[model samples]
Target: MNSLADPRVADLLARLHDEADAQRRLIRDRVASLADEAPGPEAWPHHMKDFYLPVSREQGRFLYQTVRATGARQVVEFGSSFGVSTIYLAAGLRDNGHGVVTGSEVVGEKAETARTNLAAAGLDGHVEIRTGDARTTLADPGGLVDLLLLDGGPGLYLDILQLLMPRLRVGAVVIADNITDSGAEPHPYARWVRDPDNGFVSNSITLKGGTEYSVWIGLP
Candidate 1:
């Protein structure tokens, strides 16, 4: 049986992805519109505070599998965002029977909500939600990270990665979302990871938005 299909995981996802409701899609669109207006991540205030730009169901499942596949005992996520993505990562850790996920979110209320969501899923014990800018919160997360997920502001992806570089295990996997778009401003993160000399083998994966799957293959 697929690990995500577990009753605990299935029950939580159902609450987030209500396909029958059209309003959610509209809200998401409006949030995306606002996001497009931001000059850069630092100027991008907490416009998405009241809403959740969550990972699509497939991407959530992909996160679960990715963690499980890597046998990661420690995971770090930038942008917990109400914990929809956090739950996926923690679920994988739960199935592994050990491990912890440290999630950093810029908004305090969202971090609280994510904590509530994680508790409701019965995986709260395996996760930690740090409320503040990821750049500061993830500066020292207590241990080496086996997998890193960058789902925050696209502009901050590279910065977050750089901040966590020292703690990432050699084979760590870094997944970045929203890096692929046909716009005047492209995320510079793509170039850094795709370059073989930079110690990563990376490529874009087409999902609801777009996800960059990269593996850290450099020396410690």
Candidate 2:
């Protein structure tokens, strides 16, 4: 909500700010200490999508860590921006010995850049970058997705849900980022999934902007 001035919102923001700052320092230190050939040039590239609001590398790492903690083997992402998150996810997958990430990007350029970045990160083989509307691409994804990330257009959030609902495997974790409306109630996706019929246990966390985390409960 735009009522970021509210004490609750302010407190949440402060916590996020502190956490983000700590994460940035950690990422910097990790990157700095890495051997020149450790990550390698093929580990992650520089070209990002135009709309890519790069997440704090730490946030990316955290997401990856969460996925790894869940022991997720297959992941799907609604938006692939510059492959920053892709790199993080791929790193976790690599560490897990066997995993894969499939990301969708509507913009061709963004998809291309994502591919390059994944290749740079030595993750191209572990990640698949799809160029098209995510809703459609996910409609018939070949495998059960264990984890999902939503960072595409806000208005399309519900559409993505409808498309992915039937495909989501039980126990899957869905993370939706950027769910704010400045004084408005929760976003449409949050509202819709809150309905009992949707079969999702949902909660909002005020992370960077706002993040809605949901898990499927009912059988598809």
Best by lDDT: 1
C-alpha lDDT of all candidate models, in order? 0.84, 0.70
* lDDT value, candidate 2, whole model: 0.70
TM-score of each: 0.88, 0.73
How good is model 2 by TM-score?
A: 0.73
Tens digit of lDDT per residue, candidate 2, span 1-220?
1222345433533444455455665566555655544653323222222335555544665677767788888888877866767777776776677788888887788789788767755667789888877877777766787888887756677888778777788878888878764676767778877666788888887676777888888743
**Which stretches of model 2 miss by more than 4 angstroms?**
1-49, 181-184
In Å, residue 95's CA in model 1 sits off its true spot by 0.5
Cα displacement (angstroms), candidate 2, residue 203, comes to: 0.9
lDDT of 2 at 72: 83
Backbone clash tally (model 1)? 0
lDDT of 1 at 11: 83
lDDT tens string, model 1, 1-220? 3546777768877886663234587776866897678545554547557667788888888999998899889999999888888999999998888899999988888899899989988889899999888899999988889999999878788889989888889889999988784675435788778878878888889977779999998842
